[model samples]
Target: MAVFSVIKLSELEGAKRIDAEYYDPEYLEVKQKLLKKKFVYFKNLVKEIIHPKEIKREYEEEKQDYLFLLAQNVRPLMFDLSEKKFISEEKAKLMPKNLLEKGDILFVRSGNVGDLTVYTGEPKKIIASSDLLIAKPTFKFSYYLGVFLTTNYGQKILIRGIYSGLQPHIAPSYIKTIPIPILPEEIIRRTEILYLKAQNLLKQSESLYSQAESLLLEELGLKDFKPRYKKTYTAKLSDTFSAYRIDAEYFQPVYEEILSTVSKKHRIEFLKKIFDFRRGIFISTDYYTEEKTSRPYIRIKELTGKTGIDESKIIYIKDNYPIDEANSLQENDIVIAIIGDTIGKTNRIYKELSGGFCSNNTGRLRIKKELNKEIIPEYAEILFQSVIIQSQIEKKKTQTGQPKISDKEIKSILIPILPLSTQQQIASLVQKSHETRKKAKELLEIAKKAIEIAIEKNEKEALDYISKSEEK
Candidate 1:
């Protein structure tokens, strides 16, 4: 017989395993109940459409722009397709691909696999890249299928089968075989409604972000700005000026084009006086503690996936902890992720932080005392997320085999110095957008909770809770 030691709840530390082992039969029972209550469905691949077996070895030399369902581009799917460059027909034809239809569930097969998204907008022509799987669900329940695929039930089974080693991957055949929860008809209907609202909210968020960018560009009279180009075909050029010579990835002219537009349009002198750009207080892991308090510390991992700082997920330090210079995150201070993959991304603290401590990966900027200044932290936050700044950072970044942007590049970034009125106007719109986004997030949380409750109880109870919350 197996033996186990029991320990009190006090012995457990922040979800970590302690030396004192304990067995919980209730935990397994709950898990089994949830599993038993769950239903499983599979993707229906039966169709009359021709499935291409032969991988085209060569594509034509002519370049034709088409919608690509690549994983990187799918997260923020609202792209100006006309403005984006495309692969030459020769390069495009070599990969295994399929036509992407509206409402088709897009799943990443390799490289940070299991990133799920649904194609909503109607596109004339779209091709699924080799790394993507286009789950063409029947029109009758395509939306419902997409929702199920992204939910906890679908994701749990889908991710469990990944035979990951050096790199994680989920083959299309394996993904298609995974069981999907066959939710009740009434529950599915309610889910579809919530899902559609969520979709609308997502589109609104994207639209608002675009509006914010356009307002910034228009206020500075860069609406029709076009970047300059030297040689379009510099692939064969030899590097005589530098020690390193490689592919055209490093010398991509898009950066120069983005930089020139900002420099020529915005007044550089005015920007330097408006806001004080400061690096964050460098912190180490040694400062962290198991004890929780009123104060919350912000980390890079917490801010990466979302648009702003999530206060709920903030880690708190002990109240009596020493007040180091790095531990202070004041109100209106802009936080930017300064290390690893998300270097240029920026977020602002909207409310006063209770014992605000910032992580080393986050750069904090304290706004100048002048509240009515031409450039505020909010304005700076929006500008930092603009294409102009993104392009500039990309150009100056010294790729250590991979793209890596540094804090030096972030601080040196130039901003458009516009009239105080224009800056405030843009800030106001961004604020409203943020508010709407917050509500949308609440709705998404409700959706998740409703699904969980529905699995344990019934659809009526979950819907009642959602309705009450909305009413409040």
Candidate 2:
């Protein structure tokens, strides 16, 4: 079946687009439903759009406290805070146009265009990178735009405006033409509260995970240890031959330094000794399905560390697709990205992710039944994310072609064996963080759904839905 839209010649002028993709049926259908209610043009709500100038860390200062928000940090309704970078307070002061405010909405103008996130004014002073298109909300209703852009229908409008190129992107000019459904004052306030509540939950999640990482470092007697790389270094020939590598990166002195620090307090064990690993099976795209109810096909991108699985990015496969039993995910099983730029990243599976099939690009690790008493699943997740294990992974990953760490290479990586009691404590914090993050996502869904209903149905119905959903 084919879907088509017929438009008059004059109608094309309003969209300022001549491509067939711009006239997609999904875009037309969403526009019709949005026009059913009073709406505001996206351009009308914003004071102005800004693209920040590239800022560099010109001076190395004693303090680099201010966060330098990059395109990677800005996601739809959230950010990836697993890793971070900072600029000095002096550097931040030099870029006033790039400074983020509570009411500002940051849009990814290039790469994954249309993805956006709102600033809640955390840390007070922060700067946006050049890739993001910063929109300052005139009415301070940033959440309103954030919620709309995240919804199923809202995405279609943004997708329609995307320009095709070597790198696909959207301009601030195109954003001005997108329609944002006008909501009642009561509902607007409700949406704002819900978004802020979600952000707060995310903050709590980060704090808990940070505590877990700190506990591990404290136990390792590395509470104050920071590895500094030496540009001029030497390695023994026998050491390289034993490790089966000739690369200078594998011979970095920092790797031995970190390992020596860990060996001081706890015995170290190869990852293979504690957990059995299985690479996920390949499932062809022919078996893929758009139905959300189908079995979710977990890809490498879903291995979001602290935030748990990114549910929005998850794709689905046929209900009865044939897959290997070893590829099956179980609660507490660990899924790791063995390929690409995120080569060493991992995510601990929860009950919600159980029974799904993982992609070939990932590997599944389940603790040995006999070793269950030796290590907790939560602690294992925290340990891998910490520098103790990440350094090992960094050394083991293949540098040629597309970078990757094979399952055999992963199994070869060594990890510290913290005491069972200490492991349990760190595990507890990681578990709590995941649970908090889940609740925040739920609240965001309610807000997005309510807005969608307001456009498709009526304000009264949407209000009732919100009231009922909150009670549950």
Candidate 3:
């Protein structure tokens, strides 16, 4: 079956877009419905839309002079502040217009096109990378517009304007022409309230994780410690020969500093002692499929910590791919990235991801029943994410074309054994963090759904839906 749309010659001339995608029937239907309701052009709703001037990669410095926001920093519907890059104040002064203000909408103009999020994170001074488009809306309308753009209706229209090629791109000019429905004041207020609540929860989640990390460092007497990086270090020839490594980075004083600190604080044990480890099965690409199947194939990118698994991003394999219980994920299992730049990145398998299939490039750690009394899975996960174990993992990584750490190397990394009471305390904080994040995600979903309802039905119906959802 084929879908067709009839466009007037004058309209076609005005658009100047002869591509078939521009006239897609589904896109036209959505546009017509939105136009039927009270609406205004997207450009009118914003104070300004601007993209950053290209800054040479060499200009970026490690010093925390000013924060730079890149396309990769903006994930779908959320801001990832895990990685930080900086530029000098002198350079930032040269580009005054690129500065990001709180609540400014950061939109990606290229690669992972249409990925947008509100800049609700900390630090007053932030700048956008060249590939991002900054949309500064007036007053409280930022949250409302952000939620609207993330909805299915908004995504369809925004994506429709994209020009596909080697790399799909959405020009700022296209974004300016998008139609935004002028929803009722009550609906906008409700949406803003939900969005604000979600943002607050996200902040609480960050605070709780910070507390957990602080507790771990405090327990190890490393709360105020900083590793000294030396230009040169000496090591015994016999030690190098025994380890079969001669790389300078392998002998970095910081690695030794971290290890020595942990060794002096508490008794250290290899990860293998507390858990049984296994690698995921290697299924060839031929077996992968986008169609629905029995299980979701978990990849390294899907190992998002605490945010839980994103069901929408999960791709499927053929039902007859011969999956077995051994290859499937289980609750409380820890999946660690064993290859690429994210080597050592770990995420605990939650109930929602149970029974999913893991990719071959990952390793799974399950607590040994007998060792449960000494170490809990949740506490171990927190330890894995901490800088102490991460430094060790970095030391053991092979620096071939792509970095990788063997499962054996991962199992050999030392884990400090804390008292059961302390473990429980840290584990409790991590669990609370996960819960708060989950609630935040739920509120975002409600906000998105409410917009969809308002557009598809009416304001009254959407308000009723929100009321019923809150009551439940």
- lDDT (0 to 1) per candidate: 0.59, 0.83, 0.82
Question: Global CA lDDT of candidate 1, please?
Answer: 0.59
Alpha-carbon TM-score of each model against the true structure: 0.70, 0.94, 0.88
Off by over 4 Å in 3: 1-29, 57-65, 86-88, 120-123, 138-140, 161-168, 281-294, 306-312, 316-321
Candidate 1, residues 164-233: lDDT per residue as tens digits? Answer: 6577767666565555555677766776676667667655765676687788887655667765545664
For candidate 3, the clash count comes to: 0
Per TM-score, the best of the predicted structures is: 2
Work out candidate 1's RMSD over C-alphas. 7.9
- Give the Cα-based TM-score of candidate 3 against the true structure: 0.88
Tens digits of per-residue lDDT, candidate 3, 397-453, equal: 999999998877888888899999999999999899889988888888898899899
Backbone clashes in candidate 2 total 0
User: In model 2, where do residues sit more than 4 Å from their true spots?
Assistant: 56-63
lDDT of 2 by residue, 132-204 (tens): 8898889667887888888887888888889978888888888887888878988888988899999999899
Q: Clashes in each model (backbone N, CA, C under 3 Å)?
A: 2, 0, 0
